[model samples]
Target: MLSKHFRWNKSRVELLGMIILSLFKIQNVQIPKIAEGIISDAKQDSVIKRIYRFFKDQLIDAVEVAALVVDILSLDKYLLVIDRTNWEFGKQSIISSDFI
Candidate 1:
């Protein structure tokens, strides 16, 4: 699915697969935690560096990704809600929304 939208070599494609699996396994988006969940022969630090490099080097198009996801889901019809409200949480401002 990813390859269909992104022009990535074999190693890069495999790294993305590993990162995605790690995200599901660890339930976290933090690079360090995701690295910990990745099943790799390389050292944890190496995995972390690789992940960081991937994000830094990759030119991912959000529109293409969104199209790929919509294609994968095959949703016949759905409502998309985007909340523009700004809420303060401590020192950070967060805007959350849901799709139904």
Candidate 2:
């Protein structure tokens, strides 16, 4: 699929390498591990020769779309933070967020 869209040499590395690079930036993680994880996920797909190449482009596109949306919104100028002195949580699922 990629070969028809891109030159053979670059396209060959596009699926895995590109995805790791893209995911690294957005997720702030390592490359080799990311690539390995991706490979494991795609191990069952016999037709998709390179799982790395497939995810690499998709991850990059997703981040690019997010950045585009932020640009379109341009909400930084109007940003504000409001604090509440009293707060309570009841009967709700709790999810931990590390990145604020």
For each candidate, what is the lDDT?
Answer: 0.84, 0.47
TM-score of predicted structure 2 = 0.22
Q: List, residue by residue over 5-94, the lDDT tens digit for candidate 1.
A: 667898888888888889999999999999999998999999999999999998878787777778789888867765667666996755
Question: For candidate 1, what is the lDDT?
Answer: 0.84
Off by over 4 Å in 1: 85-100
Model 2, span 28-92: residue lDDT tens: 45444444444343543432345434545543444444455566676676454545333336854
The CA root-mean-square deviation of candidate 1, after full C-alpha superposition on the true structure, stands at 4.7
Ten-residue stretch with the least lDDT total in model 2: 91-100
Over the full model, what C-alpha lDDT does candidate 2 score relative to the true structure? 0.47
- Kindly give the stretch of ten consecutive residues in candidate 1 with the minimal lDDT sum: 91-100
TM-score per candidate, chains pooled: 0.74, 0.22
Itemize residue pairs with steric clashes in candidate 2.
Answer: 15-52, 15-53, 15-54, 16-52, 16-53, 19-56
